[model samples]
Target: DAGITQSPRYKITETGRQVTLMCHQTWSHSYMFWYRQDLGHGLRLIYYSAAADITDKGEVPDGYVVSRSKTENFPLTLESATRSQTSVYFCASSPVAGTEAFFGQGTRLTVV
Candidate 1:
């Protein structure tokens, strides 16, 4: 089974537009996370979910929102896309907190 999956591996959007990225995992892991990677900022956690219906903001959660309605699916939405938000997004899942996480290939989003 596929461990993790992210949709639209690459995307290009205009500024001020709304965009949504989809993530899915097959392991039914207890923890799921959203992260954004940039040159200077490296990778920063955006949001995470401990389990279904449980979510929390991460270090860089201001411009993004995430929800986990089911253990296998976690989707992230960018309310108003910005050039600053242009980066690689990754979805990861782990069986326990602080444990090894399995990540998707990553989605590269470009906001013009």
Candidate 2:
């Protein structure tokens, strides 16, 4: 099937360590977003790219770095993993703004 996929579905890392979560979509959607799902915050956007090479910070972008050099790939990197960063990260893609978005299974990341 053609859809979005996230690598390392589950990851455990130590504090202060840097980790990168990979996300890829086959649809070549125009909008791709990275969101961290936390208990109280629900789904908070970390970063989003409107198109290849066009990126912007969302609600919570601190300690996170995102790049989209290709329409099919959007990778998010944690500069330094922290205990508070432990959450399920989701990658989503939409053909355009205000449209239905398809999400990946998500990557469960834990920081010790």
Candidate 3:
């Protein structure tokens, strides 16, 4: 069974455009989250959803948006990409937080 998956393993974009990152899971986990990992920022949450149709902003949701219409998919969109947003984005799923989490390979986004 596929645990989780992320698209575009790598991406290069300009400083002012829109990009959407895709996430999918087969476990049907009720909790899905989006996070970005940078050299110094470590791992910071962008958004999360406890269940279908229920979403909430996380620690770093300023330039990002997320939607969870189905338990199996959670997609993130950067309304307008920025150089500061250049980082690896990861999608994670878990039954709950602070426990073992399953992560996607990650999408390395570079905005020049």
Candidate 4:
């Protein structure tokens, strides 16, 4: 695909189980981010990677981990998913910061 894509647009898991969300960008953007959006609260950054071998934590990195082994792929994993982690996850990318961003539709995760 020429645009970003996410797998398992919706997910259901039990607490303490591992869940991985996949993201792929055809543009091969240098920067990729994972954010979770809740009903009352706006999107909160979970993790981000500037490029392969360069990853950093964002606003709410707890319970989430991200890796970018390739320029076009960034995957987010929830080690021991929790009920609080249930939310809509969005993957975003940009050639650089403070510029136009492309976002995947979203992955809705439910941890019971």
Question: What are the Cα lDDT values of the candidates?
Answer: 0.94, 0.96, 0.92, 0.92
Model 4 weakest 10-residue run by lDDT: 93-102
Q: Measured by C-alpha RMSD in angstroms, how accurate is candidate 2?
A: 0.7
Question: For model 3, how does the per-residue alpha-carbon lDDT over 7-111 read when each residue is reduced to its tens digit?
Answer: 989999887899999999999888999999999778999999989999999998998888888899999999899999999999999987567789999999999
Clashing pairs in 4: none
Question: Which regions in candidate 1 have their CA more than 4 angstroms from the true location?
Answer: none
Best-to-worst lDDT order: 2, 1, 4, 3
Q: Give a tens-digit lDDT track for model 2, residues 1-112.
A: 6999999899999999999999999998999999999987799999999999999999999999999999999999999999999999999999999998899999999999
TM-score of 1: 0.96
What is candidate 4's local distance difference test score? 0.92
Model 1 lDDT per residue over 61-103, tens place: 9989888888999999999999999999999999999898999
* lDDT agreement of model 2 with the native: 0.96
* Pick by TM-score: 3 or 4, better one: 4
Q: How close is every model to the real structure, measured as TM-score?
A: 0.96, 0.97, 0.94, 0.97
